[model samples]
Target: MTKHERGALSANAPKSGEADLETRLSRLRAALDGRAPRLDAPFPAVTLIFSVSDGAARAVTAQGSGATVDAAWEVAVTDLHRKMGRRKLRGRFLRLDWVEKAETWTWALLRKRLREVKRNYSRRGIALEKGFTHLFLEQELNGNAMLYGGNQISHCVVNEKNFLIYAQQKYGSGITVDFADDREVHVFDTAGLFCGEDGVLHELYGAGRNAGRRKIDPLDVDTLRGIIGDASDFLAHQVGADGRFIYGYHPCFDRQIPAYNALRHASTTYSMLEAWELTREPGLLAAIERALEYLCRQFIRTAGDDMAFVVDTGDEIKLGANATAILAMSKYASLMGTDRYAGIMENLACGILHMQAEDGSFTHVLTWPDLAVKERFRIVYYEGEAAFALMRLYSLSKDERWIAAVEKAFGHFIEKDYWKHHDHWLSYCTNELTLYRPEMRYFRFGIRNFEGFLDFVLQRITTFPTLLELMMAGRKMLDRLKAMPEGAELLAGVDEAKFEQALHFRASYLLNGHFWPEYAMFCRNPDRILGSFFIRHHAFRVRIDDVEHYLSGLVAYADYIEAVAGSSDGAVRA
Candidate 1:
C-alpha cells in the first residue's frame, strides 16, 4: 500500500474477526520460529502484547488455517511501523481490540523510542525532543510540563528527533545527547540556568536574556519598600529628558505603541509620590517632579472662558484627566508642605466641577480648545473620582465650596449605587469620605461594596481559567485587603480573623506565581520596561494605566500593612 493509504489505516485497530485466539497464536509462533517471512518494516519495530485481565500464561500449540485473518493483523502492524517512520504522531497514542467474544488481548507499546529524550552531561541536565533542547523545565499550576529552549518552548508534549535538531541548531556543537526516553522528564540546564539570590529561577527575556525576576517578600516592609523603590526607578527610566513618559508597549513584538493618556500620567505621578513618601528615594522624587512638570506643560489646556483643564495632547479633554491631575497635584502640595501647585490644582478642580451636571454626574469628555462636550454620556468612574478630588481639595484648602460639592456629588453617587460596578475608586472615595464625615450609612456602603468585590475575587480565584484572570484577581484581593480594615467591624457575616488569613493566603499565591511564571510575561525592553497587558483575551497592548493601577494598588496595600504592624495596640484603626 501507498504511504498515505498506510498512514490512514494506522489509526484502525485489528478487528475481532481478523485473528482468533488459536489463529493469532499460530501466526505468532510461525513469526517467532522464522516460518513466516520477516516483514520489510519501514522503521525499527518494538511491539508489546498483554492481556487486560489477569490470566495464566500458556504456550500456544494449536495450528490454525485462517490465512486471511492472520495476514490482516500483520498488515496492521506493518502499517503502524510505516506511520511511526514518517513521524505522524505528535502526542501520546493508545489502541484496544477484542479478539474473541469472551476474551480480549491488550497491547501497550511505545512506537517512537525517542519521543522525549532525557540525558545527563557532566552533572548538567538536558531534555531533547523534536529538534528543541530544553534548558529549563517547569510544571504549570495545572500539572502540565513546560520545556523552555533558548528560542522557544513547548507545553505538555515533546517530540524527539525534531527537538534534538532544533537544539543543536540553536546551541551549536556543544549540544550532546547521550540517551533517549519514552517518558517525559524534567531536565535542568546547569550551564544556562539562572537562580536568584533567593534560590528561585530567574526569568529571562530578549537577546541579552536579562534576568527579569525581582525578588521581594510581599509581607516584609523592607521588601515592599525595595519594590516601590525599584518600580520608581523603572518609571524614572521611562521618562524622557523632554518629560514625556513612555506610554504604550507591546511585549510580544518588543516594540512601543505610540499613544499617550493624561489621566494615566497623573495617576502614575501620584503612585511615584507614594513611593517617594515610603522610601524618600531621591531618584523617585526627581522622576515625580519631571512627570508633574510634563502634566503641567503638555496636558493642561484653557478654554475660551479661561477655564483650564488637563487634556491629552491638545484637544481631547477627559473629566478623569482633570480629576486625576487635581488629586496628584494636591498630594504633591501636601507632601511638600508648600502650595507650589495649589493654583493649578484649583483650576483643574474647577474644570471638573464645571463638567458636573446638576444631578452630580460629570460629562465624561470634551473637545479642548473650544470646550465643547465630546461625550455627554455618564461612565461609572469619573463622577466618584471627581468627588474624591473635591474632597481632597477641601481637606487641603478647607474650601467650603469643595466640601459642599462633594456632599452633593457623593449623595448622588450612593443614590445611584455606582459602586455596584467594578469601580475601586468609588470604594476608595467612599472609604475616605466615611473617615472624614463618619456617617454610618457611608461606612456601611463602603463595607457592602468591598464585600461585593471580595465575592467577585473569590469567584475569579475558584474559576481562574486564564493567566490574566489570575493576575487581576490577585490584584483585586490586595485591594480588598487594603480597604477591609477600614470597615472590618462593619462587615456582616465575616470573621475578621479568617478574612485576614484568607487575604494573606491569596497574597502568597499571587506573589509566588508572579515571582516565577508571570514575571516572564512583562516586557523587559527599556522602552516597554515593566509594562503588562490588559487581559490575556485582549490585544497584547500595554497601556500606562495598567502599570499605574498595579503600582498604586500594591504600594497602598503595603503601606497599610506596615502601618498596621507599627500600631501599639496591634489593632486596625478605623
Candidate 2:
C-alpha cells in the first residue's frame, strides 16, 4: 500500500491544520505515554503553547525545565496560565515540545554545526552578521515535529538558534548567572508532540499549512496543480523590473544569494514556459517573456563563427547555457506558435554543434567572442542538455542534422554507459529522441537510466527534484514500450508494478520540499519564500533553479495524472 493509503498522512505525516484534534492529540499522547525523566535526573524542558481561536488570548507559550517531569510540566503550565490570564480556554491549536535527549556539547558536534551554519548563514551580509546568539544550543526534531507555528518548530532536519537567545533578549547582552563556572553546559536534542486542532492545556501542532510537520495528501492532478501553482506564483513574484529574477534567497536570514548564473536564467525561463504551457495562468506568460528577454538581450553573444553562445557574466560561455537558451525559446516557439526566435535558436544549436568533437563529445566550456575552449568537461548535464536542445529543434524545424547529432551523442553515451550517472536531462532527451525514432536502443538507454534506481528514490530523504523528472520521462517511454510486442520482451526483467508504485510515491515525496506556509513563515521573508521549493538539508535554501526543476517535474506529473487519473478543473483548492 502507498504511504497515504496506509494512514500515514493522518497520524504519521504532518499537514497543518488538516487532521482532527483527536488525531493530533493522540500522536502527542502516544509519545508522552510512558517516557519520563529518571528520578532526581535532569528532566526534559517542557513547553506548551495555547493558540486561542476565540477570547482575548490569541496564543500563549511557556517553557520550563526542572528535575522531574511533573515539576517541569507544572512550571510550564504555570507560565502558560500566567500568559493566558484565565483558567478556561477554547478553540485553539496546541503544541508541546521538549528535549527528548540532551548530550554535553562536544568539539566535534560543535564543529559540524559550525560547518553547517557557515555553509548557509555565512554567506549573509548584515542579516546574520551581528547576532551574538551563537555558541549555544539549537532544537532539531527527529522528523517528528508537525505544526511549525504556535511558537513551535520541529523538522525532520534541524532548526537552530532556539537556544541562541535562550537566556537573553538581545545581542551583546550577558546573563549574570549566580552559579559556579565549572559546571557542565549541555546542548539539547529536542522533540515535538504537536496537538491537532484540539482543546485547552493539550499540546498541539499549529494550524500552519506546510508547517514542516503536517502530512501531505496523496497527489491527484489537483494537488499537483496546487503546488505547481504555488511554485509558479513564487517564480512570478521573483522577477525584478530589470527582467531578471533576483537570483534566489537563502531565506533563513532573508539573504539574496547575490551570485547569478545565466544558464540557470534560461533554464528557469524554460521551466516557467513548461508551467505556462500546462497552466496558462494569466500572469505567468508575462513573467516568462520578461525572463526570456533578459536572457536574450543581456546574455546571448554571437561568436566570430556566427555561432551563438550564452556568455556567462565573466565573458565566458557554457554549453549548458546555450542549450537551455534554445530550450527556453524553442519551448516558447512551440507553445506560442511563433518563430520570432527561430534564427536565434538555430544559431544556438549551431554553437552546440560547434562545440561537438568527432567522437560526439562536446567541450563543456569556452571563452566568449574568442570561443576558446576554457574547460573540456564540467558536468554530464551539459551533454544531455545539448542533445535535448537538438531534439527540440528537430521537432520544430524537422532538420535531419539535429537528429544525426543526437544520434552521435547517444552513440558516445552508450559507449561510455552514461546512464550510470542517473542524470535526469539524459532521460528527458532520451524520451524526446525515442518519439521520433522509436529505436529500441534509445528505449533501452532510458531504462538503464532508472534501472535499479527506484529503491534509492524511495529510501532517500532529500527531495532531489530531478528524480521525478527522470522517472516521469522514463515512464512515458516505458508505457510506449509496454504497448510494443518487441518492447514487451524487454519487460521480463523489470518490475512494472514497482515502477508504478515508485513513480506515485516519489511524486508525493517531493512535496516535502515545497514551501508550505507553515514552514515558510519561519523564514525572514515568508511572503517571498512561500510557494517555492527548498532543499531542507541545504539550510532551507530557495533557489530559482531548484524551483525550476521542481516546477517542471510537478508540471509533468500533473500532466500524467490528467492522462491516467482524470482531471480536476480548478485553480488551487483550499
Candidate 3:
C-alpha cells in the first residue's frame, strides 16, 4: 500500500479516550524534558510542536492525531512555522509515531524492502545496483512497506536510470517523489525504516527526523568577513590581465556565459574599488587599475561635439553605463589623488546631463556608433544612477552645475513617485545627496522611502522562503534603519514589535546570505571553480550586478557599523 493510503487509514482509526490522550501527552513531555520514556511502549500517536531557543528545546503545544507523524511534521514545519515570527530562532514540529519494534526488526525489514524495490526497478530495465547506496523505508500496520533509495552524492539516484518512474511503477499509484537532479528526492515511507548504504541509518534517521528542529547559529560577523574576502578574491582572480571580468556564469552547467553588460561592468569595477578601500588588498587594487584601463581604453566614446560618454564595448551607449562610469572614474581619481580621469569624468557627466530632460529624467539609452537616441522611456534604476553620478562629480569638482542638475532631477524623481518602489539605488543616491546638500526635504523623502522599504519588508518577511531574499531585503534597509532617529515615529503605522522583529530577522539573515553564494560555486573544475551570486527565485542565473550589489551592500553596512562604534547613540549619523 502507498504511504498516503496508509496515512489515510491511520487518520480514520479510532482515537483513544481523553485519559489515554493525557497519558500520551505526559509521555511526550517527558521525552522532551530529557527524561527517557518507554521507547518500546505503544502510545497514542501525537504531534508535538517545539520551540527551540538559546540551545533549549521545549514542547510548546501538542495535538492528538492518528495520522502519520511525518505528514504532521511536514505541516507543522511548513504551515505552522509560516504563521510564527520568522525571527523566532527555531520553531519545529515533531511526530512521535506509536510503534513497538523488536531489536533490529525495523532496520532489517527496511533493508529487505529496499532490495525488493531495487530488483523491481532492475526488472524494468533500469539498473539500481550501482547507485543504491541508501534506503528510507516506512511500513503500515497492514505489513505494507514503502521504499526510497539514494546515491553517494546525497542524491536519491538508485542507479544511472529514471528512479522516479521506477518508484511509481513498483510502488503503485499515490507514490509521490519530488526529485531535484538525482541528488535529492522527497519520498514517503512508514515501518519506521530509514537507512543509508554508509551503514549510518540510525544516525541519518536521528538527524533527518529532527531536521526542522535544528538550530541556526546567530549571524557571525567573522564569517561574513570571510565570505566578503572570498568574494573579493573571486572578483580579483576573475579579472583578465586586460581588466575585463568574467561577466556571466551558469553554475548548473559550470560554463561561462559569453556575454557582457557595460553598466554591470562599471558597477562591478566600482565594487572592486570599494573592496580595495576596505581590505587594502594589493591584488584588488591591481585588478581595479586593470579594469580602469579597460574602461577608459575601450568604453569611453566621443559623441557629437566631442561630448564623451562611456558605452559598452560592443553594445549600446546606455545612460546607466555613463552614470556608473562617472562614479567609478571619480572614485578612482580620488583613490589616486590625481585628475587623471577628470576630463573623462566631466565628459561622461556632460553626456548624461545633455541627455537629461529639462524636468530632470535622463534618456535611457543611445545607439553607440551613430549617437542616436535608442531608448527614451524611463527604466527602473537609470535615473537614480544618473543623479548619483552627477552628485559624485559635484563632490569631486565642487561644480554647481552638477548640483543644479541633481536638484532638478530630485524634483522630477519625487513627482514620479520613485519612492514607492523598492529601488535601493534611489535610496542610496538620496542618502548621499542628503549628506552633500542636507536639505530637510531630502531627509524627509529619504526617511519616507525607507519607511516604504520597511513596510515592504514587513509585508514580505513571513512570505520569504529563502534566506537570500531575507538578506537582500535586510541589506537594502540596514543603513537607513541605522541612520533613522532611534524611537522616531517612522513607518508611522508599523508597531515597535514588527520593527524590532525586522531588525532581529535581518541580523539572522546576514550570516545566511553571506554564505549562500558558496552554493553557486561550480564543482566540476576545482581550479576554475568560483562563486557566483545568483537570483534565487529565478533559474539561479548568475549576473555581474548580483555580485556588485551584494558586495556594495556588505561594505556599506560594515562602514556604517564602524562609523557608529564610538558614538554614544551607537546609531549611524545622518
Clashes of each: 10, 14, 5
Worst 10-residue stretch by lDDT in candidate 3? 195-204
Best model per lDDT = 2
lDDT of 1 by residue, 1-574 (tens): 2111111222232332233333333333333332222222221121111111101111001011123435444544454344434443321111211111111111111212112322100111233332112332221101111122212321112333444554464346678544334343332211111121111222122111111222233245554454455556667677777778898655433567687778888877876786677778887788788889988988897654536888776577888888888888888988999899888887787888788778777788888667789888657677767877887888899888787787778777778876566466765676556556766567556545545455444333221112222223333333454565654455544444544544444433333222122233222232244323232112223455654554565566566566667664322211
Model 1: lowest-lDDT 10 consecutive positions: 53-62
lDDT of 3: 0.51
RMSD of each: 19.8, 8.6, 16.0
Clash count for candidate 2 is 14
CA error at residue 240 for candidate 3, angstroms: 0.5
Task: TM-score for candidate 2, please give it.
Answer: 0.74
Off by more than 4 A, model 1 = 1-218, 304-306, 459-495, 509-542, 567-574
- Write the candidate numbers in order of decreasing lDDT: 2, 3, 1
Model 2: ten consecutive residues of lowest lDDT: 123-132
- Every candidate's lDDT: 0.48, 0.67, 0.51
